[model samples]
Target: MRLITYRHDGRIGTGILQNDQVRPFVGEPAMTQVIEQGIGEVADQGIPLADIQLLAPLRPTSIRDFVAFEEHVEGVRRSIDGATGVPEAWYDAPAFYFTNPHAIYGPDDDVPFPAASVARDFELEVAAIAGPDRTIFGYTIFNDWSARDLQSREMTINLGPAKGKDFASSLGPWIVTADELSPYEKDGFLDLWCSASVNGTEVGRDLLSNMGWTFEAMLAHAARDSVVRPGDVLGSGTVGNGGCLAELWGRNGRQAPPPLTDGDVVTLTVEGIGSLTNRIISGPEHGPAVPARRRDPARARHERQH
Candidate 1:
């Protein structure tokens, strides 16, 4: 079952994606309710998916994405000051953050333009959506669009990714149930293939099996010293040797500049997942912008009212 939180009729609700429509889940304002009840239990509610507006499934109270891909990690390290080593803590610690949940968009949605962004790029990732009181329930494809130039400038402060990563992160049209992806549940190798095209030109391609840290490890690490509740999303970082410009350093690894410009259309496809297509707009009206705003207060009230 592909779970989704969508919007319609000026409201947000949880629903199951079947075919081209949504099947509304009953008596649950949030997906965490369904997850805690178990998918089977939620299914028993039997509300026709046709009814209800699908919001972002559930508004995550917090989100923490980690850099779990080994190839990307090593590649990034080596590219940074010729450093090839990752911190020992990095191996043991699952780094994460509170991403802007409201910033998420659906399939085929246009990624909003960011003012600080000059070289926009796409990151292919897999996100784990927590279920049942913070238990991880399912996985979905994620596209973390990046502004390479801004990210580089921000990193010099050694603060953290911050606005560098928060510009816009895209979620799915559907969330694949954990049961379906069970083969990848126990540290077993799961093939990951990521391909990106900009304005019909190929830019990046890579596999998931190449990740340095497995999903299980990432999950465990996220749970350490912190409780990951249901509806939380854990993102697998970009693929190794597969970044847009940060890793490429103005070259496509083929001796050509790889900078993204306005109007560039980026499409990222992850194996076993779906494709996320976004267009690079010019820039935001505001300069040195903050992260995109969350849901309108009025919208939140309306959801509860329904």
Candidate 2:
């Protein structure tokens, strides 16, 4: 079943989407509650999908995004640093980073271009929603909006993508439950076709099967020495073959396509999971900038040695 959180008649609620209609849960249960328990009871008849606004399927408890596609890593490395080969350590285990769960936006929402960046881009990916017993609840399209310029600077310092990434992320039209996608599963990976487009122009497409690591393995790595609760989200990262402009630029020897600008629309589609679309808008005004302090070279060297 496809599940969604929608707002209708100025009220927000969780529902099951069936043939353009939404069968809302009897009580306005939180999505986390619905994920933990089952979709208990629902209104027999349905509300027209057109009457409601879809919200981000759920407010994720946490988000763990992984670089599961080797080609994507190679492409990004080439784009950023002109590196040609994948690092040997990448093959040893899954690698991921935690992104801001609070910055989530739903389908059709407007994402702001980060004020500090000029090279804004979008990443086409699939996200697995965790359920009870370490199983997956469902899947949704995830657009990891990036501020390439900020990310580039931060990575050179070997520290962040934090401010570069934390501004916004888009998820959902709805979540397609695991059972609905079971037929497409092959050897722990889904053989699903995923694609992305900008302002109606197709830019990239690839198979989910191209991922170097499986969601189960990534999730296992996440769980090591820690707890993974239901409602946690695991992203499959960007798919190869033009999943993001950075990858495309890397593959084409650093010749980049235009970065996402104000009013640009980005849409990502996964074969079974439906499409997620969002528009870019100007970022909010900033207050004041904090300048970084320059340390004395000798003091810095002494501190590093210690």
Candidate 3:
């Protein structure tokens, strides 16, 4: 089932999405309630999906985004200083960072243009939501929008991606239940293909099997001494070879595509989970310009080599 959170008749509620139609669950209207009770427990009332606007499947209690793809890890490192080394900690355990949950957008919403960003970007990924009994609930496509310039500057400070990443993160058209994707599993990885495109130009494609850390491992790591609530989210960072301007700008130096601009639409698609698309809107109206503009990246890299 494709579980969803949506707005219809001026009210927000959880529903089962199918064939462009919504079957709203009676009484238990919020997705959190359905997730806590399990998908099978919800009862339904029918509504045309066309009549309702799709919202994000649900607001996760918290979000943990893991850098679980070796290629992505290596690529990002190379993008920075051209190093191909993987941190020892990444191999021994999953590495993740918390992101702003309040900045999330629904599939059909517009992502506000981040004012401080010049290297506006999108990270194509898959996200797992915690469901009943602290196990997997379902999956959604994730667009981890970024401000690459700010990210580079902050990384040098040795603390965070901070304002660089908190701008916006988009999830869903709907969440496909784990059982719905189970048939695609082989060995221990799901064989689903994930891809991203900007303004209709294809950037990259990767398989979920390429993930270095599995969902179970990520969720376990997230739980440490705390709790992985039923509405919590776990992200499978950027897919290997996924094109965000940051990674591409490094490799195609001087010739890379321009960073995301206002009005550009980005789409992240995972085979079983469906596509999450959002258009950019320039905004925040008041913030300093991205600080990385002061440095010449190409010249800096040249200096490093000497």
Candidate 4:
């Protein structure tokens, strides 16, 4: 079953989507509640999908995005510094980063263009939403928007993709329940075909089976010393074969494609999960910039001596 959160008649509620119509749950329970207690009852009649505005299926409690595709890693590294092969450490374990959860957007929503960036890009990925007891509740399309210039600068210091990545992330058309996608599962990885496009032009496509790490392994890595709470989202980072512009740049010897601009529409489709589309709009005005202080050499030496 597909689950969605939508706005109808000026009211927001969670519902079951079927045949392009929505059957709203009895009391408009929160999606987290729906994840915990199964959808019990729904209205007899359904509302036309076009009449209501769809919201993000759920606001994730936390988001952990992992680089599970080796080709993606090699390609991105090549783009950054002309490096050729995947790092040896990458083979040891799943690597991931926490992204902002508050900046989530739904299908058809307008994503703000980051004011500080000119090299905006999108990553085509799939996200698994957690259910109780560390199990997966469902899956959805995830567009991990990126500010390439900012990311390149920050990573030069070996630290972050924080401000670079925290700007926005798009999730959903709706959630496809785990069972619905079970038939596609093979050896802990799904055999789904994933594709991405921008403004009617195809950019990339690859199979989810290309991922080197399993969701179970990623979850185990994530929960090593913490909890995998319900509503937590874990992203299967970009698939291989041109999943993002950076990877394409690497493949093309650093010749870059036009970055995402205002009014551009990005669409990502995963065979069983459905499509997620969003438009880019101008970002909010920039705040005052912060400057870094110069290091004091004498103080540094004295501290070292002490």
How does each model score on TM-score?
Answer: 0.77, 0.94, 0.89, 0.94
lDDT on C-alpha atoms for all candidate structures? 0.66, 0.90, 0.81, 0.90
Q: Which residue pairs overlap in candidate 2's backbone? A: none
User: What are the RMSDs of all candidates, in order?
Assistant: 10.5, 2.9, 7.6, 2.2
lDDT of 4 by residue, 1-306 (tens): 999999999999999999999999998898988987776799998999999999999988899999999989999888766779999999999999999999999999999967868888899999988888878889999989998888887788887588779989999999999999999999989999999999989889999988998787888889899989888999999998978988988888854677888899999999998899999886887875698889999999999999
Candidate 2 residue 300 Cα shift, in angstroms, is 12
Better of 1 and 3 by lDDT: 3
Model 3, 85-163: lDDT tens per residue? 6878779988888999998899869998567678788898888988766688888888888887778777887785897
Candidate 2, residues 204-304: lDDT per residue as tens digits? 99999899988888888999999888889999999999999999888887556778888899999999999999999878778656988887999889999
Which candidate achieves the best lDDT against the true structure? Answer: 2
Our model 4 lands, by Cα RMSD against the true structure, at 2.2
**Cα lDDT for residue 81, model 2?**
70
Q: Which stretches of candidate 2 lie over 4 Å from their true place?
A: 296-306
Off by over 4 Å in 3: 40-45, 287-306
